[model samples]
Target: MPDMPALHALTRSIDSLAPDIVTLSDRIWDFAELKFQEFRSADLLIGALRRNGFTVRQDIAGMKTAFIGEFGEGKPVIAFLGEYDALAGMSQEPDVDYPAEQTPGASGHGCGHNLLGCGSLLAAIALARHLAEHELPGTVRYYGCPGEEGGSGKTFMVRAGAFADVDAALTWHPAPFNGVRSTNNLAVLEYYYRFKGTAAHAANAAHLGRSALDAVELMNVGVNFLREHMPQDCRVHYAITDAGGRAANVVQARAEVLYLVRAPEMSQALALAERVNQVAQGAAMMTGTEVEIVFDTAATNLLPNLALETAIHANLVSLGPVPFDEADLDFARRIQATFTREAIRSSLRLYQIDGDVFSNEKIDGTIPLHLGLRDFEGRSHFRAGSTDVGDVSRVTPTAQCWAPTWAIGTNPHTWQVVAQGRSPGAHKAMIHAAKALATTGLDLITSPDLLSEVRAEWFEKIRQEPYVCPIPDHIQPDVGWG
Candidate 1:
C-alpha cells in the first residue's frame, strides 16, 4: 500500500478530475478510430496533456497517431502506456440492450481502449501534478500508443528507442473482472500472402487458368494440418482477404490470405512462421502461381515483472472495490441476460475462473490472484491474444492490471463490451484504474530499492535472452483492415 498521505492525495486528485477523464473516454469511444488512423483521438489526448502541462511529442517513431507526453526530469522515468485505437466493424452504441451499431460496420471501443487511453492519461496528469506540488524529481510519461488492436504500435516504438531510458512502465486494461495481468501472452507474427495467377475464362478456357484461390485453400489446409503437430500453445489462423473478383464466369487470377502465427516465445513464433511460409510456397508451386509474402506486424511475448506486479496488486487491494450502485448492477444483469449459458461457461473455462465469482452478475472487487500468475519454471496460463504492450515489456520492467469495466462474461471486440462503455459502472472502474495505476507508479517513483530490484531482474532476464523486435525495420505499420 502507498503511504496514507500519498494515497489520499491520489484519490482526491482522481476524484477531482473524474469528469474530464470520463469525457475523454466517451469522446474517444464516439470517434472509434481504427488502428493508425486515430487522428482525432490523438489530437484530443495531446491537447489535454498539453493543457495539464505535459510536453507532447507528436508522431513518435514515424507513426502519426503514436506519440508520448512527458513531464518533470530525473533518473526514474516512469511511463504509463495508453492505447486509443478501436476495433474495426465493432461500432455499437453504448447503454444499449442489443446489437445497435452507432454506424454500421464502423469502428468501436469493443476492447475498452477508450477507457484505457483516458484512464492512463488521468494517472499521468494526476502524477504530474503530484510531482510538481511536492517537488518530486521523477519524470512521468504518457505514451499515446496507437494500433494496439493489431498495428503493433508500441513494438515499433520499442525498436525506435522510445523506452530505452525508462526505468519502469505501468498500464492497465478494461475487463469484465479486475485482477493483475500475470498470464504471459503469445508472441504474434502477422503476414499477408498474395498469390498471382493467370486469369482466364472459367467456361471457355478453364484449363489455361491458374487458380490463386486454390493456393490459398491449400495453404490454409497445410496450416491446419501442421497445427496438430505444433505445440499445444501455438496457434495458426488464416483469413481469406481477397478472393479475386466476384465473377463466377472468370477464373480467379489474384487472391490474398492473411496469416497470424503465435507462440510462447519469439524464437518459436518465428520458426512456426517459417514453416507456414514454406507451406505457402508449396501451395504456390503446386498451383503454378506466384506468391508474395508481406510482413505486416509482430509482437514479442510479454516479459513479466514480479516485483512490479506485486506493487500493482498491493495498490489494487489498497484501493479496494470500486463503489458501484444498484443501478450499475441492474444494467449488468441486463447485459448478462444476453449471454447464453454456453457462452458464459466458455468464457469461464477460458479464464480458468470459477463461475461463482460472478454470481452477483457484476465484478466489483478484485478477483483472487491466480496461483499460476508467474511461470518461474515454464508453467503458466497461455494467453492466446497479442498486444503491442508486450514489446514495451521487453524493454523495461512493465506491469499491467485489468479493471472491471463491463458485465462479467463480456467478451472484447464484441457488442456486449461496447454497449457498456458509457455505463456508470464503466466510469467507476475507469476512475479506479487510474487510481490504482497512479498509486503504484507513485510507489515505484519513491522507492529506489524496489525499482532497483525490478530493474535488476529485468536486466538479468534480458541478458539471459536478449530482446529482438519481432517486426523488421523494413516492415512499416499497415493500419488497413486485417
Candidate 2:
C-alpha cells in the first residue's frame, strides 16, 4: 500500500482533474447512444485522452465503439476499464423528479455509464500524469468498453486477448451507494434460438402448415420444467423476439426466441445452457420444425480480489463520504418521494443495512470495509445483474468499487435514474469515485508485494478451473439494434 503522504498527493491530483472529468461525463450523458453505437461518446473520451498525452487506438476487436488509450511503458501494466453505452428507451430530461422522457422513449444513460466511462478514464489520466511527473516505470491504459447493456463488450475483448498483458485491473460503477463491489455476480449465456417451418394460409391450407410458434411455446414449457431440476441459484429467461406474424389467420412460418441462462459459475451455467439447447431440439422434433441456435455471448461470474478490494476501500475511507449541500439533499428528497415503499425496501434488502439512502438521499456516508468477506462465497450481497466486467476479472487480477451517483431506490434503466444525470451531487460522487480508483491503481503500481499476492490468488483460482470463452470461436459479437 502507498504511504499516507503519497496517497494524499494522488487524491489531490485526481481532485484537480474534476473539471475535465465532469465535463466528459456530461458530454457522454448528453449523447445517450445505445450499445455498439457510442460514436460521439467514444470520440469525446479518445480526444481527451490524446490531449493528456496518451496513445489512442480505435476499433479494437472489431468493435467500432471500443478503443484503448495507453500511456507510459514497462512491467506491471495496469488497466482501467471504462464503459459508455446507454440503455434503450430510458431518456429523461435532466434534473427532473417526475417521469418525463427527454425524447419520449429514446436511449439514455440510466445506468450512469456516462459517469462510469468518464470516471475510469479520469483515473487512467490521473495515473498517467502521476507516472510522467514522478518518472515512474509503469504503464496505464484506459479501455473504452462499449455495448454493456445486453452486449458483452468486455467478454469479446477478453476473447480477443485484449487484457493479455495487463498485470492488474481496476474499475468502478455509479450506483446508489459508496462501498466496495465485493459481491459475486451471476454468470450468463445469451443465445437466440430460431424455429423455421412451412407457412400456409390459415383458411385454405391450414393443415399443410407446421406452426413454428408452437415449437417456441413448447420449448419455453420445457425450460420452465427444467428450472425445477436445475440449481436453485440458476435463472432462465426468454423472449419471443419473433412470433411469426401479427396476422391471426396465417400459420406462422418463422419464429425466434432469445434465451438468457444465468448461474453461480461458468461451468454450471454452460451445463444449464446445454440442457436448454436439448429442450429446444426436442421442441423442434415434436413440432416438425427446424431449429437453429445462434450463440450471442456470455459472462463469467465475477471473481473478487481481496487484496485489491481492501486497498480500494482504504482509499475510499481516506476520502470519506462525498459532501452534499442543502440543495442536493432537497432534490434527492424529491426523487425519493417518487419511489414507493416497496422500491426502498428492495434497494436496501440486499445490503441489510440501515435505511439512509432513502431518507438521507446521499447514501450511507461510509465505506463497507469488510464487505462480503464473511458472507457465504462472498455473496451475501450477490448481484442479480450480469456484467461484461465479469469476463475481464477472469483474465486479470481485477476488483471494483461503487460510488453513489443517484438517489436511492432509483432502479437502473428507468427515467427516474436518468433524471439525476446532471445533478451536482452526481458529479461530485463521480469525481470522488475517480480518486478512489486512481488511488488504488497507484498502490498496485508502487507495491510489488500487494500485486504479487493478488495475482497469486487469481492464478490459483484459475488453475483449478481455467477460463473458457463462453462465446464459441465461430460466434461473433451480436450487436443489438441501435
Candidate 3:
C-alpha cells in the first residue's frame, strides 16, 4: 500500500486540475475524429505534455497520429496509454432527447475516446509533475495510441517495439462502471475471401455463365454449420463486401466476403480461420470458381495479470467514484428511457448496479480487490466486441481500469453516448481516473520489488511461442477510410 497522505494529496491535486482536463476532453469531443485521423486530438494532448516539460516523439510505429511523451529516467519505464478516436455516423448535439445531428452525415465521439485521451494525458502530466517535485527515481512515458476502434493501431506500435523497453503499462476506458479488467478476451482474425468466375448473359445464355456469388453463398453456409461444432464462446461473422456485376441480366463474375473469426486464444482463432479458408476453397472448387483470400487484421486475447490488476484496483479504491448532481441524475433517467426495459435490467444485472431512472446518478466508486477472476463476468456478454488491447497483455504485464463516464445502460457507438461525452459527470469520472492511473504509475516507479514480481508472473503465464502478428506486414493501415 502507498502512503495515504501522498495519495490523498495527489488526488486533490488532480481534482483541482479537472477544469483543464475537461476542457481538453470537450475539445476532442467536439472534433469527433475517426480512428487514425485524430490529428487535432493527438496534437492537443502532445502539445500539452510538451508544455509540461516532457520530451515528445511524434510518428512512433510509422503512424502519423501515434506519438510518445516521456519524462524522468531510470528503471521501471512505466507507460500510460491513451486513445482518442470517434465512431462513424454517431454525431449528435449535447444533452438532447431527440438526436441532434452534427451534419447530414458524419462521425462522432460515441465511444467517449475524447475522455479516454484527455484522462490519460491528465494522468501523465500529473505524474510528471509529481516526479519533478519529489525527484522520483523512475521514468514515465505517455503513449498516444491511435485507431483503437478497429484500426489495430497499437498492434502496429507493438510490432515496431514501441513498448519493448517498458517495464509495465497502464490504460483505462470510459464505461458505465469502475472496475479492473480481470478476465481474458477472445483473440480475433479478420480477412476477405473472394471468388472469381466467368460472366455471361443471365437470360440469353444461362448455361454459359459461372456465378462467383454461388461460391460465396456456399462458403457462408458451410461456415454457419461449422459453428454448431465449434466452442460455445467462439464467434464468426461475415458481410458481403461485393457481389460482382450489378446488372440483373449478367451473371456475377467476382464476389467478396469479409469475415471475422474469434476464440478464447489466438491459436484457436488461427486454426478456425484456416478451417474457414478450407470451406471457402471447397466452395470455389464445387462451383468451378477461383478463390483468393486476403488478410486484413488480427489480434491476440488479453493475458490477465493479478499483480498489475491489484495495484490498479487499490488506486481505484483510494480515488473513489465520481460524484453526480441531481441534474445529472435527471438527464441519465431520460437516457435510460430511450433503451428497452430488458436492456436496462440486463445492464444493471451485468455490473450489479442499481438505478431507476436515466439521469446520471453517481453510484459507489470503489475498486473491489478480493473479487476473484471467476466472479468477474466475461466481456462477451456486455456489448459483443473485440479490442487490440488483447494483444498488449500477451507480451507485457498490462491491466486496464474502466471509469463510469456514461449513464447506466448507455451503449457505445450511439448518438446517446456521444451526447454524454462532455457531461459534467463524465468530466468528473475522467479526473478521478487520471488520479488513479497516476498514483499507480507512482507505485510502480517507487517499488522496484513490485515491478519485478509483476514481470515474473507475466512471463510465467505467457505462452512459450513468440507472438505472431495476425495481420501480415503487407497490409498497411488504410487511415483514409477509418
Best model number under TM-score: 1
**What would the TM-scores of all predictions be?**
0.94, 0.93, 0.89
State each model's CA lDDT, in order.
0.84, 0.83, 0.79
Worst 10 residues of 1 by lDDT: 367-376
Question: How much is 159 displaced in model 3, in angstroms?
Answer: 1.0
RMSD (Cα, Å) for all candidates, in order, is 3.3, 3.4, 4.3
Candidate 3 residues 1-482, lDDT tens each? 87677787677778777787789889999888888899999999988888889999999777899999999988778888899998887879987755889775788988888998889888888888888888877888999999987788888888778888888888888877666656657888888898999898999898888889999999999999999988888899998989886788888999999999999878899889999999999999998899999887777777777888788778776665566667666667676667765665555565554322232332221211111111224232322357888777766788777777776676678888888888877887788778878888888888878888889878887656457767667777757767
Score residue 356 of candidate 3 by CA lDDT. 27
After superposition, the stretches of candidate 1 with alpha carbons farther than 4 Å from their true spots are 352-380, 479-482
lDDT of 2 by residue, 162-195 (tens): 9999999999987766777587789999889999
Which pairs clash in model 1? Answer: none
For candidate 2, the TM-score is: 0.93
Model 3 Cα shift for residue 329 (angstroms) = 1.2
